[model samples]
Target chain A: AQSVTQPDIHITVSEGASLELRCNYSYGATPYLFWYVQSPGQGLQLLLKYFSGDTLVQGIKGFEAEFKRSQSSFNLRKPSVHWSDAAEYFCAVVGAGGTSYGKLTFGQGTILTVHP
Target chain B: EPEVTQTPSHQVTQMGQEVILRCVPISNHLYFYWYRQILGQKVEFLVSFYNNEISEKSEIFDDQFSVERPDGSNFTLKIRSTKLEDSAMYFCATNRQFADTQYFGPGTRLTVL
Candidate 1:
């Protein structure tokens, strides 16, 4: 089975401040990781995804996440937070093979709040 | 860019009634999926469809839940009997074959009373 854990339930940061949201996953095979954002009452918007290659992967809206196999983490990072960046962030892992194909296990989620 | 689309932004139904949610996946995508998020929970995968049949599904997708690709671009999910617990925002997503990124629709808020 695959699972994701987002340690932070809520994070508040002032505009222009740096932000980091932690995500950890448990998977036996190569983990296909992704980050998604959802505003209130909206569907998920893909932030980025990591299948393989560079540990550092950049996403839309100036967000990026680093896949750290040693720690089983794929934490999202942003150098400057904008007010519009506030939303709920989720980290998900896709199952490797067999019946698990195309299945995604998501984290509880972390709500990001950007302040002025 | 083409994106996934779902109809009926909101639907209200009685507890014992059946409900159908529709989605129109991207024209060239080969995989379609349904997911739901309760008011305060994480997004949960319901089922996935490919080649006119279900390729995968989660435990939440039980006998009461069913999916179909009746046409080239339309994918639909039907819940036999609605439960209050089924109230959630349902989302439709699509991705190209062998692709890791899935694009999601605006979502339909299903409210069962």
Candidate 2:
């Protein structure tokens, strides 16, 4: 079965501190991974996605994620945390095979809190 | 910078009532999808629509759930019989093509009593 797991339920970081949110996936083949953020009362916004090639992919809002195939992990990272960056982050994966067709499997999201 | 858009930011209905949720995807997008997030739960995929038909659906998309692209600019999801468990945030998403990143709309919050 294809699934995504966000190990952390909640994470807090002081402003200017670095942040890392863990994500792990279970899939039979090379996976298409994505990171999305949902602010309160807002839609899920795509931060970044990894389809192929580079292991480290840069995203919007100074966010980046690295896809480690051997580890089945695609952890998201940020050099510095901002109070505005505090939101719910979700990790999702497309199913294996041709034309996955937007049927994304999402992980239980991690709530990020950045304290100023 | 086109984004998917959904109507009626919030809806309140009684159980057993039928409800239709509407969405207008980015004009050029070719794939459309519906997902629901129950309060405090993970977002779950409902169905994917492409080329006027459903391409895929999850187990949660039961017989009571149906999706349609009635015309050129609008897509819709209809729940035949709403239940208390049906209360959730329904999001509409669109992508330009297969395997492309999908853009989501501000979700519609459905509250069933």
Candidate 3:
């Protein structure tokens, strides 16, 4: 079955620590990948996306993601996490063609907790 | 920067009652989509509308669910007879074209009791 998986349900780190969130997808072909963050009582905000070209994509709020075709992974990372970065992160994928086109399949999401 | 907007940030309704969630997508956007996220679950796609008609829809978008752009500005998702399972955060997203980046709205939290 084609799906997106975020292995970590919850992650905690001290302020200014580096962070990495794992994401893996099972699909026949390469799909459009994206990462979105949601603050409490807020909407989903686009953090970054990967379509083609560069394997490492940079997004807002000092976040970046690397797409590894061999491993079917698109992991998100931040060099220095801020307290405001504590939120739920979702990884999604959309097929590049055929019946699955434009239909976004999202992962279960990983919640990040930042401690002062 | 343009953003999508949804009305009635939150709503509470009894089961079997009808509910219409509204959204105002970016004016320049040409495609619109709807998705729902249940508590502690992944977001699921419901439907997509283009040129005033549904171009694609998932199994979740059944008979009870309908979408329309009645006034050419406001996009709406109507659930004829909502069920308890329908309680979730419904989101509206739009993009200037298909296969492009989509902008999602703040979302409307629907609580069906």
Cα error, residue B48 of model 3, in Å, equals 1.1
Residue-level lDDT tens digits of model 3 in A1-116: 36899999999999999999999998888689999999987889999999999999999999999999999999999999999999999999888777764777899999999999
> RMSDs, each prediction?
1.1, 1.1, 1.0
The docking category that best describes candidate 1 is medium
Candidate 2 docking category? medium
Off by over 4 Å in 3: none
lDDT of each: 0.92, 0.93, 0.93
Candidate 1 Cα deviation (angstroms), residue B70: 1.1
lDDT of 1: 0.92
Alpha carbon lDDT at B92, candidate 1: 93
lDDT of 1 at A82: 98
Candidate 3 structure quality by residue, lDDT tens digits, B1-113: 88899988999999999999999999999899999999888889999999988989999999999999999999999999989999999999998866677789999999999
| Number of the top DockQ candidate | 2
lDDT of 1 at A101: 67
Best-to-worst ranking by lDDT? 2, 3, 1
Q: What class would a CAPRI assessor give candidate 3's docking?
A: medium
